[model samples]
Target chain A: MRLPNKTCAMGATIARINDGDTVMVGGFGVPGTPMTLIHALVAHGAKNLTIIKNDANEPGMGIDHLLRAGLVKRLITTHLGLNAHAIGLMNAGKIEVEFNAQGILAERIRAGGAGIGAILSDVGIDTELAQGKQIVEVEGKPHLVETALRADVALIHADRADPFGNLGYVATARNFNPVMAMAAKCVIVEAEAVVPLGALPADAVQTPGVFVDHVVALETLTEEYAVVER
Target chain B: MIARAALEIESGMTVNLGIGLPTKVIDHLPSHLEVCLHTENGMSGIGPTLPSDRADRNLIDAGGAYVSTVPGSAFFDSVTSFAMVRSGRLDLTMLGAFEVGANGDLANWKIPGKFSPGVGGGIELAQKARRVVVLTTHTDRAGKPKLKTECSLPLTARGCVARIFTDMAVIDVGPEGFELVETAQGVSSADVAAATGAPLRIPNTALPSF
Candidate 1:
């Protein structure tokens, strides 16, 4: 459904993001991560969230705040090496982390958006990652049948968005946001700048407004989260 | 080591340089070489590491190092980036490994209890690239050999690596075994064989020094 007026007040939209939801957050590190929206979720105190993303955003930053608050029941991501707290929690049996090979994970989300059931891959075949998954044989070659991944809601970060919600991503910030936007039931965007309806060039729009549910203009970017710490 | 591996790359190749030692390959490349660097973080035409002053927080490589993009650089989403990889569009992939078996089994992702970044895009790149090469030290910090009869650590992909460029030697993984391609200046053939955890196949002709 179209968002009322194509813009959402943070409080009004966040309230609809209920507890025990599956959230697909877009980012590799801090670039395309919707930090303001993430903090809003933390402030909302939604519990038992299943967060799917590329990284955990290190300790005390982005997603780490949600994890520190014990809000995440499970994390599905490709990398957690940067977040020691997440590693500690997983090792202690306090949280569950499902690791997917980065490419495979993105493809699964794409498959979900395309309404495909599964895609065959040889990525993790015969490895620890293939332990419990089905091994199907295609033309005598064993390929792991990775299922599609869909989320309850997608919280995406965009460099620019029009009032109609067409998103323009910045650099590597475009990584997972476009795909997640297509695979989620509800897609809310945190745009650094929201311009007039026709401001973003049609060809430059990475994610069309059709996939977006709401657009929330960010107040400002916190530089503290921008630096890459080793 | 990276300097030697850079020689293997040809012009017009689409290459994916993995993290660690392989990432250094970019610096040793010829000034006029025209290969396009693809970072699995969804960008092609990767440029050299940007200076901190010129670095944009939003423009970083897959390894989180600030990087610039070439004039023809095209940014895409993760799905398209990986589709290029999984479809074998990459001409070469140079990766770092904890151990690579005689049969080309790569185990670079995890080490028992140590934390790993998960098998990010290593498996796909290794499995689907036209040629898979590894850039690593001959041994671990404690001087234990990383080339193995079989990978004791978790395997990233099966029978994928074609060649290895290490500090001690350049070896090609052949059906017979790890054949010694060339030996480094300070490393003796005997010493290279002894340091290898797996059996080494010596070439009949005199080995060249790199």
Candidate 2:
């Protein structure tokens, strides 16, 4: 179904927090994500968010604010290398974190996009990985590794977006955003620049706005995040 | 020869075991030694076993899927997983091999008609681990031994593999060349030589049982 343009203006756009949530922030190490929306969620005081990301954004950066606010309950991410807030939270036993190998993490996102229930792998077999899990022996040897994952809401960043929710990303910003867009049930795209419908090029559009369910022009990205110790 | 190979594995060793032959070490490790398994995905201090149920359907190993937790298993996210490998927390990494150079460069990831699922922090393990072990079946499906001067498959890591353990012989990838450390119990060095595709260095020694 075609969606109407909803401004990402607080309660107007982001209505309520839902279960089985997955937000895909752009950039690898906390560069071009939708910081505005992340802060919005922090202000909105949402909880039980199951974030799907590449890295934990660093201090005074993207998701660090929410993590600091204690809003994120669970995280399914590739690396939590940068965010000190995450380290404190995990060490303190306040949050739940699930680890994913980089490439397999990407494939899990893609698997969700394709609507496949699970994908079998040979990556982690006969090791600590096969623990507490199924090891199907076929033809006198082990085969088929199955991982199940999917998402409900995908939050992304784009370079240019149309009112109808078509979107494009800039530079290395295309890392996990496009795949998350496909994997999510509702995609909310935050753009630096917003144009009318049909402005973004067909091929150049990394994540087609058609996948986007919400859009709003970000005012500016110059704010120095005021992170308070929780 | 078994003593020498056992020297390759010592007590309190943090081992990074590859699939295939390296997995056999689980059965052979001396009961007194404490060899922790540092898989690329996460989970350390692993014991030798697999549990029976999918209690946690979301938990996965390096490849990403539900895996049984061992007795002494501990869980952490990805950052610590890589840190354990990259920060010298692991003493040894028993790698797999597709091709091996005279100087011990190893390739084990890419294979024909098989999907490349993930690399899962192996590069760091190769670069940072104290000792590297290459464990693989001696020959391909066509009976050609995988030992070679250079790798033909996609390189997972470089300049790190030290020893080679196969179903045929336990060889060492030394600076000089592929040295035969030990052969399988039922096989001769000559039989291994005929089966292997590459020229190797084998000092006269009895085959060691793993």
Q: Could you report the DockQ of all the candidates, in the order they appear?
A: 0.72, 0.05
The segments of candidate 1 whose C-alpha lies over 4 angstroms from its true place after superposition are: A1-4
Candidate 1 per-residue C-alpha lDDT over A11-37 given as tens digits, one digit per residue, 9 for 90 to 100? 788777888999999999777888999
What is candidate 1's TM-score against the reference? 0.96
Docking class of 1: medium
Q: Give the best candidate by DockQ.
A: 1
Evaluate fnat for each of the predicted models and list the values in order. 0.76, 0.06
**Residues B1-210, model 1: lDDT tens digits:** 778999999999999999888998899998899899999998999988987778888988888889998899998889999999989899999999999999999999888777565677778888889999999999999999999999999888889999999999999999977999999998889989999999999978999988
* Tens-digit per-residue lDDT, B1-210, candidate 2: 223344578777877666545555666667787667666544676554434342232233442223455567765434356557656788888766677666677666545345232344554566568888776777777777688777666665566778876777778777777877777777888887887667887786555654
Candidate 2 local Cα displacement, residue A128, angstroms: 3.3
Please state every model's RMSD to the true fold in angstroms: 1.8, 17.4
Give one digit per residue, the lDDT tens place, for model 2 in A179-205.
777777777777888886567777766
Residue B126 lDDT in candidate 1:
82
